[model samples]
Target: MLGSFRRRGCTCKKKRCTCGSMWYYRYDVTDPVTGKRKQKEAGGFATKPEAEEAAKNILAKLQNGTFIEEKDISFVAFTEQWKSIYEKSGKVKISTVDIRKAKLKIILKHFKEIKIKDITKLKYQEMLNSLFDKYAWKTICSVHETAGLIFRKAVELEVIATDITKGATVPKKQQTVEDLENGTEIPKYMEKEQLAKFLEIAQLFGNANDYPVFLTLAYTGLRGGELTALKWRDIDFKEQTISVTKTFYKKKEVKRTYILQPPKSKESKRIIDVDDKDKLVINTLRAHQAAQKVHDLKGDGNVFVNISQIKGQHLTTDDLSRRMKILLKLAELPSELTPHSLRHTHTSLCAEAGVSIDQIMQRLGHKDDQVTRNIYLHITKTRKKEASQKFADLMKSL
Candidate 1:
């Protein structure tokens, strides 16, 4: 139907069509699949311009093969249905679902009642910008992804004509010099020397559990959650490797504290090589664990445990972070470094030792080598500069 179609008043004898105040457009077309003749009408338009605008939109949808005359569905209804299907599909983690639901509130606040078909990339960008000030980039990205999924589902169901989030962007806060100087920049790993000093101090003065956890992370590059979720069976002393099959994810729900979950990604489920020094540390930690009777509760076969003061309970990542903060302070190291920095430190040290990028990616359980390469390149370049300065000093002495 074209916008130039003329509208006519209803000629019904009774009060069937009160078309005096309103104008409508009527047309007949054959259904493509069923070959059945169907009459479509665009009604309730108060004026010719309104009817023309509706006709233009309807005509555009028809020309583009997105003409769905179904009743417009509210965003709230569509999102609720999509969420139920997505959560029930078991493709995403429960923790992820919880986080996504929490982030979705930011979107629902603005677009709850609006029709799903009316949402556009501009609206999504507006929502993202509104959320940019209060939330982190990670949270904003999650919200964007969640909203995108809902929109995609709507399109698949033929509820909407187009996906509006295709060109939307989640703006990242720009890093400033003050952020860099104050150590408020992206989280980074420790240097090899700094790691060595920190680990030595941790061994001497840190709690019994901190040494093993730090050693495992520094040597294996396991994520903090993976480190905490390690089981005794995952270790193979003869093969000198640790199999990563699961992780301990912290749940933000009020009723739940944390849960043992699968690895973050398929690549995360890998076996990391263990060297002689790491094996020795592991053996010593095992001995300490047995002596301390840390795994007394159901003898749950987890490799790492809390200190004796905490009854050797399984340590949360948060607990490990707290221990790391204290260890860094005592070791006179930069307080900005967290437990995750150990993983970065491990990757950097491997690169400095001339390890191949492919091998580093496998060891770190990364799905792709691009991020690993970037980190390796940065660390190697810095090391090269340091080496050149050291050689200059050597020549000066000569």
Candidate 2:
């Protein structure tokens, strides 16, 4: 850190102009392009403490590839840059990165190629207001998050004087008559009938692992990552439960090649039962295990593998998604439903079958999941009405 007490300050914002009796600092970082050392400086700080703090942040961002020099950067361009840095940074989980990537795409549609320096809070909030009736509140919040991060970074890097996202309020979800009448407000998950039909379709049209995989997902409510990480040893036929100790973390997201990480929470590492009354999942699993021993298809490492064209490596959540799309297309079910939606589906169905909410949460390895609770409550409300009607009919008959 350097400070000039008598010397006139460079009084500059474009990197660091020298002569900061006002303090300034200089540092070296590797250039992203040339892969060689490059000098960088940030100045115009009024106090030594201020200069030191700015110096630390600027040096870190520059080293981490977050602060790149650009002129008149477009809003979309700034967002894309911010997203690139954000994803590369190790602060967030890989899934959050993917979510932010998608959210940014939605946000950019409104901002277009307008220069980032020109966007006002009024303008940014207008875009958010436009989204209120069109999207769910949760989805709009995600868009707000993506936009907020970009503008905040711009202020932090001194590209803009103020963050446009500050004090911006996202529009709340509005209810329509259709939402009330058709149960459209419920979160995405298969109904009991839709699930049964989807399972049958998978049995007939799915590839080798598809039937077992989807069935296991629906029956047991394991997260795609947790299920993908399971080994043959994780299953206990004697207890009729599957132990979920670790989850498969995608290697590109982490440093380790053998990327089995612990469960999402301590509660996530519990045993869940398998095999409903007609002995379906266990029988399917038994048959699946036998197929792994076949000479051509090596299926020994993980519980779920590529018995189809991909061959031996364990299946990824993305792979499961692609297969689900294909099966959903074949089955004529909702294309929007993801593998995780099946977790919600299991909660709803189990609730209807008289499984208590606590038991379902334990089985799904959730300490306290609002989504699961919502689905369970929705199912029980329906059951409550049915019971009320049944009592009314019995009284009328008497």
Candidate 3:
């Protein structure tokens, strides 16, 4: 309920309140938990129409769910509420939530005590600009996104009237000279030949564990996390299939830890077919685990572990990356290649084998075909030459 009245003293848009009368508005808002009405009133509008208009707006907001009394709330306090809603919504991955929280620290340093309504577009732009001197565009963009989300939430809750980030300019990252000169793009994967050579060298080392881990990654295109989270039960030897049901993600805040969660997406939960040789390698790994009495530490059924480590815990993504570097050295492969390159290698190999992009998406557990296609679409010098030659041959025949 909303009501307005003109105060007794005198004013009606007279421009000077020297005459005492002013318009006032009163509204009744229900206490959410208690079945009682709470009356809120505000006064001092120069005109009765202005008071009535304000009352109407408040009534509309109350009718809808967006009404909230946060005009005096500090930005940090509002951020806490926003974070709670974001986490409870479960719309983003935990890793993404962690990343956003970390990014918010930078924002809180500058705007912690400021009211959300007072942080204008210029202020936010200046904050982003300050970061540009010390950080890359991508990092600054992430901060911008976090700040924008908070502000947008505030607006949706009627805590603020507008999103200030709407007009802020975020620059794109500039390409380096080398990137432009050579038209060189990041390699999607280790080439098939390079992968074969690396795997061959890994096999020679004959470690019961590391060799099989690499083989599984290459054969199944499982993510580093998915590979680490695998259990013996997830693999079917007769069917030559590996079931991807769970995933591991790294968390690093106070301390580093690996957490097991569901696979990244529905498509990520899949069964990958493996060749007979790969199955043999898996069997050999199972035998080696038994020989080493790994069943004690692997009681939870984590497939990959650092046997060299005393704890014998599940392998972390960072540890896997470090090990890949060492393997690259032994295989005489590029130092830039990492375990994720194996997935890319699998996608590229599939593309070269004339497999359709949809099939490649399934094989790689990618929800979107564009993701599978984008990585393999890079045109190399050799491919460019082959295309030119084919075009020339067609011209000659004509």
Candidate 4:
């Protein structure tokens, strides 16, 4: 009685109604706990035996207690669950998590209501194309990557039978020559004569606030964040060194909010030695400190405060960039140079001076000597040739 099939004839003008047609199956099952009768219907079977076998298998699964009810959870529901689990694990940093959350919101706007199983590879591709049409290829790729991660978690949790996102393709972005050349090629360094002329003009700007900050970045090779986070405690006038401990970022959600965190790596946290060549800069900082002391009587202690708002906090990265732009214009320097370019200039100057790679690595807080070597390879070759020529000159004198 649990498995039964019914044959139905097509309404065709045939003599015996012997033409093969659709068949239907019906099965009855009882809940083991509740003793309630449940009926299941399946149709479109070509033969009676096939219909009976399907019904028999269903009855067997019901009797054995191995039948699992498929859940119809939507894509949005799974994403929320995944995000909650990911946040609780604390594997990702807050800033990175915030970025991922933003990207997920964009994805949820389109495919949130669809069930996980309903998402086919074709549907995934269409979503990617939509994202690509609206945003940059890089952004579309980021969304694709994040979506894949979400689907992978769903598969791990058995929410879906498989990850449908795996078969989807991401479009490749076109890159300009400048984009590829960046970081691989170092811009020309300031010649000794250019350095002298630039410093002369730099001394003329002469403001205690902007000029000092610019000089500090150029002389110490500190990042804008590291420089902004500097405090009086970080400076050791007696030892002529500065300790880099923290970096800063402005949260995009709350524009004015500043977050202070450690540097990107262990190597970023190190001491920078100040040499006698920078005695002029040291003297200038001392004068600025005296001025800051008078201003801090009102109780603000940020080292790089805006001079007008002495009571206000130090400058942000945007503020530094704006100030640098103004200074570059005044110094008759090209607009192409950025604050980070000063870091490159510092490395180039040291390499050209015949400084050893190990010492340069320590000075620049680079964890990998290979990275330092790679960046300064051209300078190293020039230094090698100069050294060889010097040896020849000494031999001729002998």
RMSD of each: 7.4, 11.2, 7.5, 8.9
Query: TM-score per candidate, in order?
Result: 0.75, 0.59, 0.72, 0.65
Please give the distance, in angstroms, between residue 246's alpha carbon in candidate 2 and its true position after superposition.
6.2
- What total of clashing residue pairs does each candidate reach? 0, 1, 2, 0
Q: Supply the TM-score for candidate 2.
A: 0.59
Question: Once superposed on the true structure, which residue ranges of model 2 sit more than 4 Å away at CA?
Answer: 1-81, 106-118, 130-137, 155-162, 181-211, 224-226, 236-240, 244-271, 275-287, 295-300, 316-345, 365-374, 385-398
lDDT of 1 at 112: 87
Candidate 4 local lDDT, 1-398, one digit each (tens): 36566766567675444676666777675655898976755555666676676567666666887543324789888788889988888676566667789889988888888877556565678788777667887788788888888888877776754576897888766678888877465564454455555556666774557667767776777888888888878888887788998888778879767788787567989999875675866776777787777555435456777655434567688777777677778778778777776766777777877777787777777777554576579678877788899999999998
lDDT of each: 0.77, 0.78, 0.77, 0.73
Q: Per-residue lDDT tens digits of candidate 1, residues 40-78?
A: 665555566766776777777778876775447899988
- lDDT computed for candidate 4: 0.73
For this target, which candidate reaches the highest TM-score against the unseen true structure? 1
lDDT string for model 3 (1-398, tens) is: 87546565664576556665656777888887997998866555657787787677777888996676547678999999999999889787787789899989999988998877657565687788788777788788899899889999888888976687887987666788887897635455787788889888878864556677787788768899998888878977677678999888788863548778888888898988775654665676666557645534746666666666545677777877877888889988889888888888878777676667788788788878555666656523356678999999999998
In model 4, pairs of residues that clash are none
Judged by lDDT against the true structure, how good is candidate 3?
0.77
lDDT of residue 203 for candidate 3: 80
What pairs collide in candidate 2?
A: 4-21
